[model samples]
Target chain A: MLEIKNLHVKLEDEDKQILKGVDLTVPAGEVHAIMGPNGSGKSTLSYVLSGRDGYAVTAGEAALDGQSLLEMEPEQRAAAGLFLAFQYPVEIPGVGNMTFLRTAVNAQRKARGEEELSAAEFLKLIRQKAATLKIDSEMLKRAVNVGFSGGEKKRNEILQMAMLEPSMCILDETDSGLDVDAMRLVADGVNALRRPDRSFLVITHYQRLLDHIRPDVVHIMADGRIVRSGGPELALEVEQNGYGDLLAEVG
Target chain B: MADTAVLVAQVPTVEGKVRPGQAALAAHLDALDLPRGGFSRAARQDAAQRLEAMGLPGARDEYWRYTDPAPFNAARPEPLEFAADDATLFTAIDRLHLVFVDGRFDAAASDPLTAEGVEIESLAAADAGDDHWASGLYGRLEAAGQVPVKRPFAALNTLAAADGLLIRVTGQVARPVHITYRRSALDADVHLHHVVKLEEGAELTLLESGVLGARSNVVIEADLARGARLHHLSAKRAKDPKLGLGHIFARVGAEALFKSFTLSVNGAMMRNEAVIDIAGDDAVAHIAAAVLGDGNIGRFHHDDTVFVIHGAERCESRQVFKKVLKNGAEGIFQGKILVKPGAQKTDGYQISQGLLLDEGSQFLAKPELEIYADDVKCSHGSTTGALDETALFYLRSRGVPRERAIVLLVLSFLADALDEIEDTRLREDILGRLEDWLTERAGNPGKA
Candidate 1:
């Protein structure tokens, strides 16, 4: 459902290239995991795909179900069924989490010419989904991530994905700050949202989070390019040997 | 040419006949012949001299940058000929009534409450013997620097103010007193001076409402005693699309609390100036205001300036101002706080936020603070931005439609200021008016 062909992006006014000829594709009913060391361009790829500013797509194209994703604005891309679970979600003061989620969901609906949900219907839908994710109703009433703990904010992002139910979802370092218990809860939330027609690209630094989600394919990235691709056991091998073994092999 | 010359001979020069407004004001000042003792009297004379020297504030004056007072150049409103009948105005605000018509107190409309150890009487009736605080504390709150270069209207108010309210609370006053200055006549100018003395540990709340017609100018002076607390909330809802100006001078004693909320919803040209002085340690003062206008309804201006003296340690002061303008309406917020050398541990915060509903609307916010003390926490922020696009989109996405979303967002933007009012009844009343204004805009969306 998602395809990126020889994607190259650079800082707007600088010669430094952040993403150098990166290529990836994920078909329906499959999960892909991209593990990389610090500054390997994992976060940059998510930002570029989600249409955030300050990144110039020098060459190549990113398409969702054969539709161009690079040409759309961030909100438009969100409406087009593209969701990026930000590593550091913007803390929006005075905007409640439930209010923000409803706005985003209804905005996408409006863009697609669908009837909007009433307050009662919205409350019912969000409440049921939140229960499965173990998110309390009170947490939804607070300002969007405004004083939320690290784990709660990540869970809130997943809650948004469940509400929007995007065609393609990108999890950027979702496990970076989670404790063992919080990581398990986050992985469970993501697993529950998985479907046959939906796809997820989980990015992380450690193999611990993968123990719960169980990706079908695993890719190791080094220096802005994918260096190796293997089955789920590859994650186990990397966990034992560390990125040093992979980096030496790539060199 | 002969007819033109004859008309020129018949007409009086600008200097010979005081512009009708100026002439009436001069006559009122001459009639008062205020004694030299009281600060109100001395301040009046000083303001008059400054008015004579500086003249009316025109477009050229930096302080009058957004609004032009020249429209008031034509006819000066005389004090109302008859006592103002305030039955209609008093009903609008549900509280104990204190009525002042044409700058004179009306005893018939006042309530008798002596058991609470609170005295409410006209300044004219106040005795000099036992009412020592009234005379001693009166005019003690001095305006810092040279008194502001007087505009003609202020000079006029200083000159004409006569009998107003003198509220003295020996103990806590449970109920708030509603002071209504109702202007029914077309040409009416009322000058008012109010003295409020709260003995040690006393508390009082005063609600001021100004309802006036065409050509009205008013001024007020207030004083608060040591260890006392006072909250003043004033709202001006003027009709006739004429001119109205109000000046307030207040002094707060040591360990006292003074809080004020001023709202200007409709006016042709309205200016509310407040100068407050914090004289004692542990005192707190808060000034909050909200103004809204559209069309040729004129401009609303507020100047809140505070002066904190030395030895007033642990004093706190804050000012929050918000304005919404549309259809060429203009709003201005100019605030300043000065901290003296020994005023350590002072906490002062000021914020002014505004929204321009249309391209033609304008807002100017200036917050200035001067601190001489070493250990002080003082900060001010000003934000001038259009409505949040994301917020609007979020609301519209919920099937609320675009116009309803804008109304809700605008109301939410103003909710912060409205939430500050301690009285729920008054807060709801203001919110209801705000909703009505928003509804009117929603009904006629095209005009905006």
Candidate 2:
């Protein structure tokens, strides 16, 4: 269960406000999609929820399973079962993908006061997860996101989501630069990890990705606020009409 | 010009002005008795006079701008009381060990000096001989390295080194030769010089570890014949407050390969200078160093000065230096590539990067390219900055703690320099050690 109550946020270095009194809720086992035009504060909502720096939360509260998230660090948020799949996966040279995954997995486990996974166990689990996503062993051995194509970066993010197994997954514009086949592959990867206790906040501009993943609900956001909420058909309506009619109707 | 001065035993005055610090050099030399009447007797005599005329470095010198040379030129080594059990870095491999304690060879602690396809003789033994095979080679390359720059410490070592190894490899040596330097007493100042020669079609890997002493002036002069290959790797992580000066001079022949990499973790002051000359076509030479320093522990300052001369056609050279400094530590790099007239088809590259964790830490670099040839490719770059904030956020968002993420980023930054190591096992070993160092200090920014 993820809940946002009248969330307000502004840029740390500027006077611009990115999120304004947005309210939303996602029950467990539900997939919700946010469809909006450009400059709709879609990414800011995700970043603020994930505890990323450079955002000052002026008001409201965000919580995962009744635990406040704004007070925790990014790593603490990750350990608390909140995962944000960055739209732009950072290219970190010198650190291999496999190493990053293992370290992340072990770190979360340790934070939760669980026994850390051994090297062999972590390697086996990552190999199994990567196999389903068609990630080759060579890709896992290279530096994280270095020399990776657009689709590869997205797939790598899915691999990370799978490894983390978070309770609330936020895909921030994950389908922007992805092609059809690549989007389907990524959707399948995300769909495979869906469980009864897991919830997803898939943020995207198009409805094709929702067609594959099959979101249960959709929300229309504009000017840093969500104006309307509806079922899956709402995504198709916005996709066909291009958010013009929706924004005007709400106005 | 300095080499010629050694041959003539006279100061090669330039522009009718003598080198600075000669008076200071004379006063500094008055405190010690130089090694005399050895197999390298004439060479030592000439070097002493040459060093007198050239003088030791000072704080105001151009090349010594980033690093103060007063420590190296001090009449005696400052007292460094810190000590630990010195260990060899290559214990995972089957290699011959030559241990030196306080500038003297410890025969009981060292392996036998006999190896197949290789001949090793201590400087003590070589000095006893009136005529020796190393007579022409010893101190020759060091003298030659002094032409475009002044390396007074190396000259001082050539004149007064008490004991070192004289190695000659005629065939491929399967095992590496590891030289471990250790000091068992305080206030130990050592002047040790080593001479290494590789004949045609020969190969050898040399390894050195540990700090020489509280104040150590060390030199390794290498002469590589045609088709020869030499791999030199050193680790200086005494974790103590001390000063060390090291020089590596090599003369490479046609189709030869010379690669040197040094990993310096923590030291009060360490200066490494490597000068290489490509005497024949189709040779390749690479010099790189990965340094980490924390001034909070004591005082940390590391400098790497390199000069690569391409005198032949189709020769290649590379210089990679990466440093991570925190708590007011400083790192310096002065690297240059000289493409002589008609030295066409030269490929040279140089890059230096520093990741400073705090406002007090700094990295200074001087990368130079002096090329007279038209058909050549030379690139040089230097960068210094803090850890990438985005990368840090990415790692932290993935559940890695803030401290551990910093260490991981540092390992990533040094990956390019570590890649210069061709041996996988050795590289991994060094990587593991680099991690330990970072996790110990760099991981905890304010912790000493």
Top lDDT model? 2
Model 2, retained fraction of real contacts? 0.88
Least lDDT summed over 10 consecutive residues: which range in candidate 1 chain A?
A87-96
What ranges in model 2 sit over 4 Å off? Answer: B1-20, B85-88, B442-448
Candidate number achieving the greatest DockQ relative to the actual structure: 2
TM-score of chain B of each: 0.79, 0.94
lDDT by residue (B1-448, candidate 2, tens digit) is 8898687777554656654587668767886667784789988988888887778887788989988887777788877777584374688888999999998998899999988889999998779988888999888999898898888888888888988999999999998999988888788888888999999989999999877888888899999999999999998786676888889999999999999999998756989999999989999999999998888777899999999999999999999999999889999999999999999999999999999989999999999999999999999999999988888999999999999999899998998999999888888878887787778774455554
TM-scores vs. true structure, each candidate: 0.65, 0.95
lDDT per residue as tens, model 1, B1-448: 9999999999867775555444544544554535343434545556666556555555576766655656544444433233332233225554677776655666776665343757877765653234345555443332232254344665554444455667788888777888777654556544565667777778887887766445555544556668888878876654334466666666677889888887766444666666767778888888788777665444434333333333478998887888876777777777777888889999988888878888887777767788899999998888888877655533432233466556666766676676567777777776766666677767874342
Instruction: Residues A1-251, candidate 1: write the lDDT tens digits.
Output: 99999999998889889888888999976889999888889988988887766789999999998889998766677777888887776565545677767766787788778888788999999999999988998999987787899899899889888998888989989987889999999999999988999999999888898999999999998888888988998898889998998899889
> In model 2, what lDDT does residue A208 have?
87
Give the TM-score (vs. native) of candidate 2: 0.95
Deviation from native of the Cα of residue A166 in model 1, angstroms: 7.2
Superposition error at B320 for model 1 (Å): 2.8
DockQ of each: 0.07, 0.87
